[model samples]
Target: MKKLIRLFVFFLMFFIPASRVCAFSDGDSVIKIIYKRSYNNPPFPESTNNQYIIIDGNKSYCLFGEGVRGKDGKIGARVDLMKDFGNHTLYFMGPMIPEYTVNDYWSDSLPAMHWTIVNQFTTIKNNYCQKAVTNFRGREYTAFFALNIPIQDGPWKFCGLPGLIVKLGDSKGIYNFEMTSFEKVPNEYNLGIGKENGDYSLYKPLFKKWHLRRLEKDKARREADPNCLDCGEGVTVRYTFIENLLD
Candidate 1:
């Protein structure tokens, strides 16, 4: 498997058609939450990335609002992270390289976040929210959840709360996610990946163990290549992965 992945890394110029991965079609998206995500990846602080979370009946999909925005300002079909609370499963898809157009995905059981709801209270976007804390993956997080939302989920692997998390930030203050807007979709939305008729068999399944391994290889490549254009002279390079790679 490692050899296969290494081959893909080097020979990725050869096109592999992406598979059409479908989202739950049983229900329409009831609500969508837009989050203003800010994080520090070292060498850079307070980096901003917008994220969106769409809630269906018993499933939710969270994805970056990068390539999925249409010219009409509506969301296009794309799925980055999907949570199926009913099945206790999660599907993580990412690193959408335009050259390969290969849909890379991985699946694992939902993480068990033992959140402790606190007595403290606050309001976010006019919603009454309460404080909750939990140790997820490797970081301790303080989250503010909206009681009125009545959804047990949030941005980026935060769930098991009594309501939707309105704001989340790690203890180190390196990462912060806050809900900016919430709205109900006027029509049905199907979260999907790749073209409609694309071959699902071509989708690559990435194992969790290989994630760090791949990163290390890329790091070595970058370090050895003095001509790497991403880094200029005197520019300091550092990496701070959002989640513990080991987890």
Candidate 2:
């Protein structure tokens, strides 16, 4: 009985988390996701401020921007969407660093309005701009701007779209993100305030803290071995904002 009980408890613990992670409901609206960048690259050496917007029916949600500059001097941006509703949490999935340039600074201003591929490839009548693209690991990507929608904006310097950004990333596979699915949320989405004039600024300090922490950890590892080839290197970065916005 004791052994049986222990085995049952173990199975329960293992399956519970796994089930929660994998159990996704069907019939929920599905948004196609594509990472236009590479995979696993750094976040600096590309553009700085990034932003995004999402429009559902007539309602829209905007997330502030966030930026990443890895130890290797690679830069990338991140935009948040509504919280995860089902089994999947909203996430970026492309290269995180830049591939070509060394220092391409983006503007703090927003983008023009435009439609996404998902939005039928139609124009939304806003000012959209191209940000930057960088190679990371080995892939390539481009970032863009969508400025018509005002409600959706987030951390980093990511912004300028009609609806919020549904996808973003670079070519080298460093950083990538997309909205897989979303449900009607009740609370009013608010853009917090700070360095960038909103909650997105919070990620600035957080990125700094994490970057420094990683640097220290990597430095120690190098000290112990002295021959880590991947220790430090800068790469190119790029950004693109799809004109159609969705599809």
TM-score of each: 0.70, 0.27
User: Highest lDDT, which number?
Assistant: 1
Residues 161-246 of candidate 2: C-alpha lDDT, one tens digit per residue: 33334345644344555433332322222222111222323333543455556567767886786555654344222333321111
The parts of candidate 2 lying over 4 Å away from their true place are 1-39, 42-156, 188-247
lDDT tens digits, residue span 46-165, model 1: 678788887776778886563355667656666777788888876666443443343655555565578888999877776767899988768899999876666677887778887778
Predicted structure 2, TM vs. truth:
0.27
In model 1, the worst 10-residue window by lDDT is 13-22
Question: Residue 172, candidate 1: how far off, in angstroms?
Answer: 0.3
lDDT of 1 at 200: 19
The alpha-carbon lDDT assigned to residue 147 of candidate 1 equals: 66
